[model samples]
Structures are given as C-alpha cells and as structure tokens.
Target: MAARREQDFHWAAVDRGELVVQQCRQCAKLRHPPLPRCAACGSLDWHEHPLSGLGRIISWVILTHPGGKDAVRRTGILVELDEGIRVVSNLVDQENAAIGARVRVEFGEPGPQRLALFRTLAETPA
Candidate 1:
C-alpha cells in the first residue's frame, strides 16, 4: 500500500491535535509508523488508538543544514511513549533534552502543515 493511504488516519489525527497509534484489531497489539498489516498477528484489520501524548526521550541528535547563511539546526528525537510505543519527531524547544527526560507532544505552529513536536515536561507550566 502507498505510505499516504496507510497513514491517513494518523496524519488526520495529528491535524486534529491528537496523537494515535495503530492497533491490530484482532490481536489488540499496538504499533507506530502505521502499516497495512500487523506484524504480531499478521492482521490487516486495525484501528487508531489515541495516545496520552506523554513520553520520554530515549535518544536524540542535532541536525545541521550545510548551507552557510541559511543553515539551520534542529533536534530530532526518539521518544518512547507511556504506552511503550516509540515515535520519532522533532524537539520543539530543545531544552532539557536528555535521555529519560519526560516530554509531551504538541503540534507545531499553524502553517501549511502541522507536525508532532515534543517539549520537556519541565518546560510546561504547572
């Protein structure tokens, strides 16, 4: 299946300001990076399971563009959600970006497209 068709549900959910994981309808197993079939049960049936939007940074890296004047630096992270599903997204604020740092997902500023980004829990106001 084409990538867009397989991930339409996920991107749509994100656009609605929610995060979701693909769950195997038959086995009830959860997976990210949506797929046409479940790896665990080999079932093509699945549903979008809304996530808590909570996770911890497991790893991260700094990406730097090579262009001189137009250079840009962004932090890319791998987050392991509370549900144990891992998601790859950009770090929004990039403060307190460390392994095991708790984070929450937030959508990027409104634009032509929105993205799932993360910020450290500590940075969030109580």
Candidate 2:
C-alpha cells in the first residue's frame, strides 16, 4: 500500500513521526487521505505540509468488542485540527472522551507500525 504514489506523501510523513496532508499548490487547499487531484482546483500538483499536532474532539466512539490478537477496548475519535482538517485516529490511554474537548496529536509505534493518535488536553463536556 505504501507503493501508491498518491499516498506516498502521507505515509512518508507518518513514518517520520509527523502528521501531514496534501496541499494544492494552485488553490492552497488541503486534502487528507491523499487524493490524485485537488477537489477545489483540480490540480494534480501538491505538496505535504506538517501539522501543528493540535486538535479538538468533534465526535468519537468506543468499541468494546473482542477480537483475536489486537482486540482491545479502543476509542475511535475524530479530531478537527487547528488547520481546519479532520483526522480519524484513536484515543490512547483514555477510558472515556467527550465532544468539543481539546486534543493533541501523538505518534505511536504500536507493534511494527506507526500510527497517529489523539489525547484530550481537556475533557470538558457541555
């Protein structure tokens, strides 16, 4: 999967312990989950820009199902970064989470793969 040219930029950054997204050179639009062309300007040329590692929890779900090897209770969270892009990652070391909570991105090396996770800076609920 790393051989895909479109995802190379994202995986390359994640491999180095950083979060990045595709930015269109023409319209200055940012695209995540990397695409072949910019949806805003239809430009195929783009670059990767590192994020601030700051975000806010917009929504989340905790899975309690059991699995084979890596089956553990995990919280899947949707973080809206300060840059206006939303990334889907897991909440590490958190038993519960709240919406609208402030969060920060953290890179984790779980097993042989590296992943981006979020931790709530403030678990404020309204």
Using lDDT, give the best candidate's number.
1
Clashing pairs in 2: none
lDDT of 1: 0.86
Residue 21, candidate 2: alpha-carbon lDDT: 92
Q: Which tens-of-lDDT digit does each residue in 51-98 have in candidate 2?
A: 998878888987665544445567888888999999998998566588
How far residue 30's Cα lies from its native spot in candidate 1, in Å, is 0.5
Residue lDDT tens for model 1, 65-116: 6665324467899999989999998888776778888899999853468888
Error of 1 at 106 (Å): 0.6
Backbone clashes counted, model 2: 0
RMSD of 1: 3.6
TM-scores of all candidate predictions against the true structure: 0.86, 0.86
